[model samples]
Target chain A: MQIVVDLTRCQGYAQCVFLSPDVFQLHGQEGLLYAPSVPEDQVQRVRQAVAACPVQAILAGEEVAAGGG
Target chain B: MAGELRDGRIVVVGASLAGLRAAETLREEGFTGSLTVVGDEPYPPYDRPPLSKQVLIGGVPADTTGLPTRRDPDADWRLGVAATGLDLLERRVLLADGESLPYDRVLIATGTRARPWPDAGEAALDGVFTLRTRDDASGLAERLDAGPGRVLVIGAGFTGSEIASACRERGLDVTVAERGPAPLVGALGGTLSQLAAVMHRGHGVDLRCGVTVTALLGDGNERFVGADLSDGTRVEADVCVVALGAVRNVEWLADSGLAAGARGIACDAGCRAFNMYGIVTDDVFVAGDVSRFPHPLFGYQMLSLEHWGNAVAQAEVAAHNMINPGPLQRPHLAVPTFWSTQFGLNIKSVGVPTYSDHVVIAQGSLEARRLAVVYGYRGRVTAAVTVDMAKSLDYYRHLIETAAPFPPPPGAADRAIAADVPIPSDVPDPKGLSHEPVVALTGHLPDRRLMVVQPTR
Candidate 1:
């Protein structure tokens, strides 16, 4: 599964980072860096991160490909 | 069990973050029965954290801050109507519109509202405002844009501090009056609030601490012009924001037979609410700022959290427990986490900071303003707060969850953990502060003295 974070809407709350640290990391206070492609073992964690995001800035699965397009 | 749970009329009260998320989770968990969401406000669910930050900063319009739904929950939306009462016996929700909706299971997420000034007439003054709803933010945003002579913020809590930050950024003179010893003392404790006080002063805010607003001195025409403080000083301002914090919307549940009051509705770890007689109800659940659920991490204390993450996590847990059978149901054990951005600082905290008795600067220096303060209670890590050092918070959260020893061991921080002595956290009693604390440590007195009684066996 692939994921994309809406950088424009990301307020750097870091809920995703806390849930799925392998996929998302906060560079500084507000700069967020994340892996777009989720590892097979990390898919469930990524899904939880997606729902746990306070701003709902995360998108996964086919929605990521569609959003990128 | 799956077949038995597939269909049921589930009714969700409150259409804000918790309510919306619960509805979505119910559908996602495959509960295909009738779903109805009832809200007191006319607008649908919207994100509120931005209302005090970006909206006040004029970066986004308040009305445009609606939350994006994961998918259509296909639920009946009941907007602009308050849930007047809950008939637990008949399993019906009584609305203020004189209509009753039946439900097989009900989720109460009525959240909270801003506590207005005690004086109703003074609160009705033209320039007085409270930031809670979208309408409140929009109106305050417009007033700030008009360039008021001075803005008098009556509370130095998160909302009040953010408002002062916005005013200073917008080049408007502002004065903050806090009843505590320093800004954020009631929430983050006295140690870090000193830094907050410095930041406020450093930003040219007329910071006045240890004083309360005696009276809002409105002009003869009922327009706010200034305020008198307890220190025998008056501040002249064109606008005033009463950031005195929130009051739970549990008034409607007065006769509902639930154990709800000023501290919010009491619930078990599974989000199942209890009655006044302390009996847990299987069909009824509670979530969001309106919930007071016991957390094992905090000594099974009932923690009432007003954080965004908790609202989402608890709502999902409540929805899952509503649909699944007993054995398959899970507890809402997610540690309470919240973040605040103000005065160019990103403050993030995990676990209940107020639950701790001591705090140590485990990483970085206080002067640098980038450090992680780990809180401990009875030799175990209870919570941690990071000011601009948010990356290390998750590690502390692990320590808290595992009940790691206080003054955390080495390698938790990027550098070797400093052998700093833990100091008293100096968390003031909530009763002494004017603003409502973000996390209320209600009904859990770990330090209370208990007598040992011996009886003949």
Candidate 2:
């Protein structure tokens, strides 16, 4: 599964990091770093992180990939 | 569970973040039941965190802050209508319009409303405001856009401080009157709040701490002109924002058999509502700021959190539990997390800081205004707050979740001098504060030294 975090919308609430630490990490107070590609084992955790985001900044699935590899 | 109950009616009361998210989650979990979401507000669910910051700063219009729907929950939205009462025996929700809607399961997420000024006449003044709803934000934002000569803010809680910051960012004069010793004292405690005071003063805000607004004075036209303080002084301002805090919307459930009270509705870890007799009810669920649930992490204390992350987490748990059986249910055990951007600082917190007796600067330095304060109770880590140093918070959160010892081991990432003697957290009793704390330790106070005394001879 593919996932992307809308950096523009994210206020660095860090819900994603708390739920899927392997897939997302907060670099500083505001800089959010996340893996765009989700591994098979981490899909459920990524999905949960997507739903848990307070700002709804996480986007999952290939439908939202926007032609990115 | 009976096969006939598969397509039951599920009603969600409150159409804000929690209500909307729960409804969507119910659908995602394959709940083929009829979903009805009721909200007192006219508009759909809208994001509120930006209301105080971006909206007030003209970065975004208040009306445009509506939350984006992930997938249509296919629920019947009853907006602009209030839920008057709940009939546990009949399994129905009574609406304000004299209509009763039967439901097999109900999720109570009525949330809270901003506490208004003591006097109705004063609160009704044209320039006096209390922010909680979208309309309130829009009105206040409009007032701020009009360039009020000077703004007087009562209560220096997160909202009040953010409002003062927004006003200063707009180059408007702001005078903050806080009944507490300093801004954010109720939430972050004394040491960090001192830094907050520094930030507020440095930002050109006329911060007046340890003072309470006795009365809001108005002109003959009923427009707010100034306010009288308990310290025998008056602050003349064109606008006054009464950021006193929030009151739970549980009055409507006063007669409801649910365990609803001043703190909020009492619910079990699985988001199942309990009756007045303390028996958990399967049909009625609770979530959002309106629900107080016990957490093992906090020593089973019934924590009442008004944080955005908690509302979402609890709502999802409640929604999932509503559709599944007891053995398949999951507890809402996520640690409370919240963040605030104010006074040119990004402050984030995890766990309940109030549930601690001591705090230590785990990383960075207070002098740099970039540090993480780890809170502990009885030598066990409980919470941590970071200012411009959020990357190190997850480490402290791990320490808290693992029940690590206080003055945490110094080997973690970006580990500072953990041996720095832990100081008293200086968290005062909530009774002494004017602003409502975001996280309330509704249960036992942690680390109360109870001496075991033997029978006197």
Candidate 3:
């Protein structure tokens, strides 16, 4: 699965860093750093990270259709 | 468990972030029931934090801030329709258009609205603005782009400070007038507010603390010309932004008999809405910025949080409880977290910082404008606020969740010494605050319940 963070939309809230440390890490007063793709073991956490983002800046795997249950 | 979970009409009010997330989570939890989302606003759910940040600084257009759903909830969205009243006995939601939505279960996530200036005449001025919805951001952004002579922000809370930061970032002269002793004193306490004051001054912002803006002056064109401060000074500014705070959208429930008031909709830890007499309702729930639920970590004192993290976390738990039977229901007890960016500093917080008596610098140095201040009530750590330090928040959140000792331990920090001396947190009374305390304590008095904590050993 691929992980993507929109650089422009990111506000450096770092909720993702707390939720999924293995996949995402935030530096001192800086934007987060993370792996572009996730292994099978890390996919669950990467997905959680996406939902945890305050701005919805993170996208994991294929982007879900806007407005799907 | 009473009965098997089955398909039923699930109605969610307020199509904002919390409402949208709860709807999405309902489906994720395998609820094949009919779902309907109702919102007074014409547009679908959109991000709000940006309305004060990048949108104000012109980084992105306000219209493009719609929150992308991970999966569509396939809800029958009732947009631009306000829910007038809710009938608990009939299990129906009365709409403004004379329609009623019948629901087996309902989630009230009616969030909050930007608290407006009390005076209608002053608020009607052309240059006055309050950031809450997409249209508000668009209108305010247009003024910011015009490079007004001076921008005046009335409030030094997070929202107010962010607006001032955006103005400074855009190279527009800005003045911040706050009623508190210092910027962010209502939220992060005295010490961090000092750092925030320094940061704002460093950015060439004219910040006035411990003073209130008594009146807004107009230039006769019905445009904001200046503001009269209580300290006997007048600020000449063309644009005035009111970042006072948010008021919970609970007026619709006035006759609903739910325990909702200015504080917020009162709910149990399980997210079930309580009646006026404090009886918990089964089918009705509340989440997001509008719900006030007592947190166990803070002596079960009820809290109403406006943080983005709290909204998402509370929504998931509320959604889960909606599906499960009573015994199987999980409580919404996630540790509160919030972050803000302003004046080139990244401020992050975990736990309820305002729920404390003393604060100790746990890491880094306040003089350097980089540190984590641990908040304690008595002797146990209650909350922590970190400036320009995001990584340390996880550690502090753990300490808060576990109810660790005050001053915290030294091992978590990279610095040689964690400032362990306890100083008064200096969190002001909610009544004296110009803005609503984002994390509000509604039940019980703080002085009586929030007695000081000393070391357990």
- The candidate 2 chain B region of ten consecutive residues with least summed lDDT is B448-457
Q: On residues B1-457, what C-alpha lDDT tens digit does candidate 2 reach at each position?
A: 7343347999999999899789889988889978888888888777677788767876567765566556768888888889999999999999998998899999999999998899999999999999988899999999998999999999899999999988998999999998888999889887899999999999999999888888999899999999999999989999999998899999888778678887899999999998887899989999999999999999898999998888888999999899888788999999888878787787889888988899988887778888889899998999999888766667777898999998788845555664377888899877777788888877744597553423223
lDDT of 3 at B80: 89
Residue range B1-457, candidate 1, lDDT tens digits: 7667769799999999899889889989899999899999888777687688767877567875666567667878888889999999999999999999999999999999999999999899999999999999999999999999999998898889988987887889999999989889888887889989998999999999889898898789999999999989999999999999999999888888888889899999999999887899999999999999998898888899998889999999999999998899889999988877778887888888888889988887678878888888989999888888766777888999999999888755354234368889899998778799989978846598563332213
TM-score of chain B of 1: 0.96
Per-candidate TM equals 0.87, 0.87, 0.87
Off by over 4 Å in 2: A1-56, A59-69, B2-6, B412-415, B444-457
- Chain A superposition TM-score, candidate 2: 0.86
B331: Cα error in model 2, Å: 0.7
Clashing pairs in 3: A68-B71, A68-B72, B377-B453, B378-B452, B378-B453, B379-B453, B379-B454
Q: After superposition, how far is residue A13 of candidate 2 from its true place, in Å?
A: 11
Model 1, residue pairs in steric clash: none
Q: Rank by lDDT, descending?
A: 1, 2, 3
TM-score of the A-chain for all models: 0.87, 0.86, 0.80
